[model samples]
Target: MAPPTTTNSWQHPSPHLTRVDAFRRQVNRRYGLSLETYHELLRWSVTELEAFCRELWTFCGVVCSAPPERVAGPDDGALDRMWPRPNWFPGARLNFTENMLAAGLAAHPDAVAVSACREGGAAWRHLTWARLRDETARYAAALRSLGVGQGDRVAVVTTNSVEALLVLLACGSVGAIMSSTASDMGAKGILERYLQIRPKVLFVESRVVYNGKTHDHREKLGGVVAQLRKAVAELEVVIDVSGSSWSDGRIKSLDNFLDVRTESLRFAQVPFDHPIYILYSSGTTGPPKCIVHGGGSALLQQKKDFILGFDLGPDSTYYQYTTTGWMMWNYLISALSLGARIVLYDGSPLYPSPDYQVQLLQEQGVTHYGTSPKFLAALKQAGIKNMPPLDSLQMTLSTGAPLSAEIFEWFRSIFPSKVGLVSATGGTDLVAGIIGGSPLLPVHHGELPAPSLGMAVEIWDANGKNIEDTGEKGDLVITKPFFSMPITFWGEGGEEKYRKAYFDTFPGVWHHGDFVRKIVKTQGYEVLGRSDGVLNPGGVRFGAAELYGIVDQFSEVQDCIAVGQRRKLDADEQVLLFLKVKTPPLSDGLRDRIRTTIRKQLSSRHVPAHILEVQDIPYTMNGKRIENLVKDVVCGRTAKVGGTAANPESLEEYEKFVDLPLVQSSAKL
Candidate 1:
C-alpha cells in the first residue's frame, strides 16, 4: 500500500477576489481565453504585450519564433508548415552569455553591478558594469585557448564565485556548451551529470570556501576526474581555480590557462538556435532529462523574467540564494542583462547566525531579490529578527515549488505594504520563469502576476481540454509551444523525446505535468497549491496544503507529509499521513484530537486511515520536501538520488518505517 491522504494544517480555497475590469479581459484574450481568473496584470492589449516582448528581445539580442500554437505534420501545406515551423530570428546570430553579461555591464553601463561576501566578516567584492565585462573577456580569451570552440562542452565542479560567472560567459562568448555542478555535491553526483555530457575541458576548484571555513574539494574531485578520464576520450584540459598543487598530464592552474591568451581576440558568434548550455530536470518524475537550450531561447526567457517580470533595470541590484547545480543560479546570473549588480553567496543564507543573509540585504539595500519558500520558512522557524530592511527593494521572487500563502504573508509583513512578491515559476529547461510578478500589477498576496508575456498558459482537464470553470482544478498546459521550449534533448538527435515528454500526453498541446489551477480567486488573483500533488481517498480530493494545515497544527507534530497511498484490494486507496515529531509518551487524547480536527475541517474521507510517526521528514538538499522522490521510494524504485540534495539520510528512516509493525495495521485502514 502507498501512503494515505493528508493536507496542510493551514490551507483552503480562498474566496477573496477583486473587482474585474478591461485589464482582466485583455489578459485572457492574449493567452487564449477571457475567463475571470483573479490577478493583477490582466489589463493591457495584446499589442502592448507584444511591444513588451519585442523591446525585451531587442535589448537582450534574443531571437524568438511565434508560440507553438500552429504545429502541423511535416507534409502540411507550405504556409501552414513553414509559417509555424520555428519562428526564431532565422537569419540573425548572437551569443547566449553575451546578453546577460551585456545587460549588467555593456548596454546599461552605469548600474550598481555586484557586491559579494563569502562568510562572516569577509572582505566584500564589488564589480561595476565595465569591470565585469573586461574580466569576462579575459576569461573568454583564456578558455578559447583551452580549445573551447563552438559546439564543444565545458563542465565545472565549483562554488559560487566570480570565476564561475567568468567561465559561463566565456564559454558562451565562444559558443561552448556550459555545464556545472555545485561544490558540495559528492564526487559521484558530479560525475553522473558530467559523464552524460562528456565535456572536453573541466574547470574545477581545488577547494571551496563556505561557513567561514575551507573544505578540500580535491579529495572528491580527484576521484571524479579519474572516472571522467575513463569514460571520455576527448576530455583533456583541467583548469584548477584552487591554485592547489597538481602534476597530472591534463591539469593546469587557471592562471597559466589564461596567461597564453591575447587582449584583442574576437568572440565567436553563432546562429540563433546554437546550443549554449546543458541543464537537467529535477528528476522527481523519472531520470533527469537533459534539456539542451539554444543561445537565442535562453536569452529571451532570461531577459523576460529579469527585466519585465522583476522590474529590473540599470538601478537594480539583484540577490537570489542559489548554487551552480540548481537552475536558480543560472536564472539569477541573468540579472546581468538588466545592467544590475549580481549578489552571489557561497554560504548558507542563515549561516553563523539566523540573520546571515538578512544582514547582507540590510547592508547592501538590495533592489530586487529572489529566493525559495523553504528558505523563508526556515527564517521564520529560526525567529531571525530585523532582517535588513529591503526599503530599496522593488520586488521579491520565489520558485521551486508552491509558495504557501502563509509564507507570502509572513514575508510581506516584515517589509512595507508596497513591497511585492513576484512568485516566480519555471525550471532549468526554460532557463528562467514562465510566470513572474509584475511591477505594474497591483500586488496579490500569493498569486503570480500573469502568464508570461508571450506564453500561452492554460488550465486543462484530464482529457487535455480547457477548463472553463474559474475555480475548477486542472493540469497546467501550454496551448502553444513558447520560444523558450528546448530545441531538443541534449545528446539525442531530433525531437522524439521532446515531443514524447511534452506533447505525447496530449495530441497537440504541451503537458507541463503540474496539477494546478489558473484562477482569479477572491481578489482577482491567486497562486494555489499544486493539484498534481493532491491527496485523493475514495475519489474525494484534497491538496497537500489543505492537509498540512490540519495535521501540522498539532503541537507534537513538528512537520509532516501527506500522500495518497494506493491499495491493492480496494479501488479507493487510503490516505497515508506521515508525521515527523518528537517521540514521546504524550497523551493519546492529543492524537485523537488531531485526527478529529482533520475530519471536522475537511471531511471524514479526508482523514488519513493510518497516521504513522517518523523521526524526521526527508528533504532535497535545497531544503524543500522531496515528495515524489519519497513517493517513488515507498513504491520500491531505485532512484539515482543526487549528492546535492540535503539530508538524504532522513529518507532512510522512512524506508525503515515499513518494517515497523505499525505499517500493517495502517494498511487495513
Candidate 2:
C-alpha cells in the first residue's frame, strides 16, 4: 500500500495527438505493426486478441449483420482449456439498436441525439438524430403491440431522461432485454430488480426530479404494479413515463404507449450473445446480482470505451452523471454508438446550487464528462475556484469511487489543462473499463491511464501469482476474455452464478474485486479500493482507497467511510474512521487532524482505530462507497440495507459502531 510517487502530472505529446493517436496510427497502418506506444498498442491489444478484435471491428463502424467469420473463438471445451470463454463475434448478427440508430442516422440527421435536463433547471429536452430514430420507432412499434419479443424482459422504472433513452432504444430495437432502475429505486428496490427479469415491459416514472424535489411515483407506481403483477407472470405492459392517472388493468399513457403508425425502424438482428442489458449487483449485502449484458458484447465493449477510451467521435458531447440505476447509465447510452451527443442530466448533480453541475458542464458543451469521486470531492469542498472555461472539455470521466490522489490534484486545480482527467475502474461486473483512460497515455496523478484495450489486466497475488511487475498490491485479475463478459447471471443458478461471481477467485481468472496497484513508476493503474473492502489494520493491508486518500484532504471532511472492524473477541482488525462532517461535532482538533493525516499520508499503518462522526456516508445507488455496508455495520453483522442504497438511512449510523470503545479493544498495537 505504498506506491504513489510517479508524477508526470499529465503528458500526451507525440506529434500532437488525440483520437488515441488516430487509433495508434490506425493500428500502425492496419497492422503492418511497429506500434509506437499506448503501451505498444496496449501490448498489441492484450497479445493480439484476434487481431485486436478485428481492428476493433473495423475501427468501430460496427453495424454488423453477419460479419464475424471469427474474431476469437476457440476454448469452451473447458477443463481449463486455458481459461475458456472466448467466442466474441463468431458469426455476429448484431443490432444493438441497429448499431445505435445506424450510428445516429449516419452521423447527425440534424445532430443533437438526446440532450435532456429536468431537476430544477428544466427546459432543455432536445432529441434529434431524426428525433432519436423517430422516438425509437414509436417505442419499437409499442413493443410490438405489447407482445414484446426476441428474448423479452424490458423493465425501466425511469429517469435519466428522453424517456430513459427511449426505453433503451426501444429495448435495443426489439431484441429486447433492457432492465433499468432509477426513479429512486424502492418499491422493494423495484421489485428486487424487476422480479428477477420476468419483465415483459414495465417502463414507469410518473414524476421524479431530484434535489429540488418532485418524486410522485404515483404511490410507488401502484405498489410496484401490484407487486409486479403478483410476481411477474410475465407482466405484459405498464408504460406511464409521465402522465400517470393510475389506471390499473395493465396501465398505459405516454400517449397511450405510442405506436404512431409504427414509422419504420427495424433492427432486431439478434445473436452475438443476445441478451442486452439487465446490470445490477450492489444489492448491498444480498439479492441484486442480475447482470446479463450482451448485444454484441454491449456494442463491442462500449464502442471500445467510447472510441478508444473517451475520444468519442462524431463531435462528442456525452456528459454521464448517470442513474437509470448506474452502469454509468449503461455507459452513457454508449454515446449514441459514437455519433455522440448524450448529456441527459435528470437530477441533483447538486441541484439548485453547488455550481449546478459546473453550470451544466459549462452550458452543455460537455465533450465527454462522466463524473464521481464524490463529484470531485464536492468541487474541492465547495471553494470552487475557477472552472467555467470549458472550451469543449475533452475527457473527464472518474468512476463511482477511488479517484483520489487528492481528487486528482484537486481536479488539476480546477479543470481544463486539456481535460483528460480519467480514473475509471470497471464494475457492475464488467460493463466496461477494467482500468481506464488512454488518449494515448500519461495522466498519472493517481494512475489508471492504461490496461483497458482488450483488457488482460493482471496484478494477482494472494497465491494466484502475477503481482503485475511487483509494484505489489494485488487481485484485480481479468487475464483474458474481453468484449464485455457478462452474458449470464440472472436466475436459476446462472452457471453457478457466473462461476461464483467471476471464476471463484482465479480458477479461470476474472476475479476483479479491485485492490489494484501496478504503478512501477507510472505504467499507471492504482485503484486500491474494494478487494472486498480491503482494510485489515494490525495485520496491515490497506485501501479503503488509502484511507479515503488521507481523509479526503480535510476541509473539515464532508464524507468518508473506511472500514474493517472484526469484533466478537477480535484478535486484530480495528480501523473504523466514519466522518461525514462539513462542520459537525467532530472536533478533538479535527480528530487529531484526521489521525495526523493518516499518519502523514498513509503509514502509521494507515491510522484509524475509530474516528466516528457520521451523519451520512452510505452511498450506492451508484455513487458507490458503502464500504462493505460500513463493514457489516461495524462487524456486528446483520446489515441487509439494499434497495440500491443511496443512503439506506445511512445504515443506521453504522449501528453505533457495535458499541464502540473501539469494538471492545484489548489494548495492543
Candidate 3:
C-alpha cells in the first residue's frame, strides 16, 4: 500500500512562540539537553514516562496543596498484572475544582470565564470568574448542608448550561464524585446508569429545547425519581435546576435548595487517586460500565492536551459542540484552568440555520473550535459555501467519528487556509486524546499527525507483534501506562473487570479496540473503525470506515452503513452496504457506479455483495453510526436497543434484510 501524496495544509506561523515550544525549551533547560524536533520529544516522553508526567505537572501549573511523594509508582510488568493498582501521583493532595478555577480567579476575577447560550442563536450570558467562584461556594455549602460529602456520589440529568456546570464544580469542591447524562435520554436510560452508582443527590432539568421544540419533562422526571428511589436506597435528594412543580417529598426547586448567604469558597483537598467523575460506556449492546477517574490524572492529561496538543492559552476562547453526556463537555470546561474562556451551549447546532454555529463563533471570537465529523457532514450536505471569513479562528478539531478524506478536502475548501484542521482519535475510556494535534507540526489531510505526548500508542497484529511501521491495519494498543487511565470501573470486581475489558485481549498491553494503520511515509495514523466492528468477508479483514471513505465521495449518499452479516445457513460472512440516499433514490446505475468504484479503488474482495437503499440510518446520541446494532439485526439476532440511540426506530427498516436472497445465495459459494 502506498500513502497519499497530498501536501500538508497548515503550519504554525511562529512555532517558537507556541506554548508547546516554550514547554520544550523549559524541559531542555531542566534536563540540560537539546531536543529539537517533535518526534524526538515524543520518543523521550514515552521512554522516560514518569519524568514526562512530572514535567507536565510542573509546566501545566497545577495548583496543589502537597507535592507528590514520587512522580509515579512502579509498573507491575503488564498493566493487568498489578494486584494493587498503582497511583500516578502518590501522596499528593489537591482539589480538582480549585485547580480548575483558582488561576482564573487569582489573575483576573472580572474576566469572563463562561459564555452560555441556548438554541436559536440566543443572547449569550457571561459569568465572570469572581461570580463563578462565589456561586460555586454557595452550591458547595448547600451540598454540605444536605449531608453530601467526600466519596459520596452526586448525579445529574441535565442540559449543557451554566447551572449544570455550577453544580458539577460545587460537587468537586466538596470532594463528591460527579456523574451526568444528557436531558434527552429517557427515564429508563438515565436510571440504567444512575442506579449503578446510587448517588445521594440527583439534579435534573425540568424542560429541554432542541431543534426549536420545547419538551416539558416534569412527568418523566417524576417517574424517574420514583423508580430511582425504589432501587437506590442511598438516594436522599432530587434538586430540579429549572423551576418546576414536584409532588414528591424528596424533590426541591433550585431556589429553595441553594444556600445564598455563604459567599466564601473552600476546596477540599483529597489524595491524588481520589475519584473525581464517573462516566458511562455506551449501552448499545448491554448494561453500561461505570468508569471512575482520578482528579490528579484527569487534570494533568487535560491540561497537557490543551496547552501542548492544541496550543491554547489565556487569550484563546474555546468552544466544543457537545452535550452534557459526552466526554467533550468535560474536556471543554478544562480550558478554564488555563485562564481561557469556554462556551457552554445548549440545544441543537442546526436550529434556525446551518450556519448559526459559524455566526456564534464569529461573534464570540473563538480561536479554537472542537466539533464532530457529523456536524461538518451536515454543513457540507446543506451546501453551505461562501462562509464568512472567520479571521479569529485558528484551529478546528474533529472527533466522535472518523473524518473522511472527502470531508477533509471539503473542509479545507470552505475554511480559511490558515486555520488548521485537526482530526483526532481517542475514547471516553481515557478523558484525553491518544493521538491528537501538535502545535509544532503541520496539519495533514485525513490523518492524525502525532501520538499524544504521554501516550505510548502503537499498532499490533493478532500475534501481538508491533506492526506500526508496516502500513498494515492492526489493533491500536497502548504499550505503557499513562496517568489518565480510569481509576477503575465502579462496582465489586471492578479492577478485574477493567483489566478484562482493556487488557485481556493482549494479556499485558491496553487494547484500545480501535483498528488503525500508521502511514509509513508521513508518520500519521488513520483510524479505520472499531476493532470489534471490523468486517470479515470471506476471511479478508477490514474496517467499515475504509468502505465509507470510498462511498462518501458520491454526492448521492446522504448517509450509509456497512456491516458484515452471516446467518445460520451461510458458509461465510457477506458484506452488506445500506445507503440512505438523497432525492433521486438509489438507482441501479448509481449502485453499479458505487460497486465499481469500490472494486476499482479497494480490491474486489472489498466490494459488498448487496447495495440496498434505506429511508434512514441509525446513530448514537453522539452522532456515531450504530454499526453493531445494525449488524445484530441483520444477523437474525434480537437487537437490544439501548438509551444511547438518537433514533432507534430507524433500525426497524434493516430487519427485512435479515433473509436477503443475495445473502442466502452466498452460501452456495
Give the TM-scores of the predictions, in the order they appear. 0.84, 0.34, 0.96
Q: Which digits, one per residue and each the tens of the lDDT, describe model 2 over residues 369-434?
A: 888888778777876645588888777888877787888887776676666687888887877777
What lDDT tens digits, residue by residue, belong to model 3 across residues 446-465? 78898989788889999999
Clashing pairs in 3: none
Question: Comparing 2 and 3 by lDDT, which wins?
Answer: 3
Index of the highest-TM-score prediction: 3
352, model 1: CA deviation in Å? 1.1
* Model 3 ranges off by over 4 Å: 1-8, 74-84, 662-669
| Candidate structures ordered by TM-score, highest first | 3, 1, 2
lDDT of each: 0.64, 0.78, 0.86
Q: Whole-model lDDT for model 2 versus the true structure?
A: 0.78
Off by over 4 Å in 1: 1-87, 103-112, 247-249, 284-287, 520-532, 549-558, 567-570, 582-604, 636-644, 656-669
Per residue, candidate 1 scores C-alpha lDDT tens digits across 395-422 of: 6777876666556667666655445565
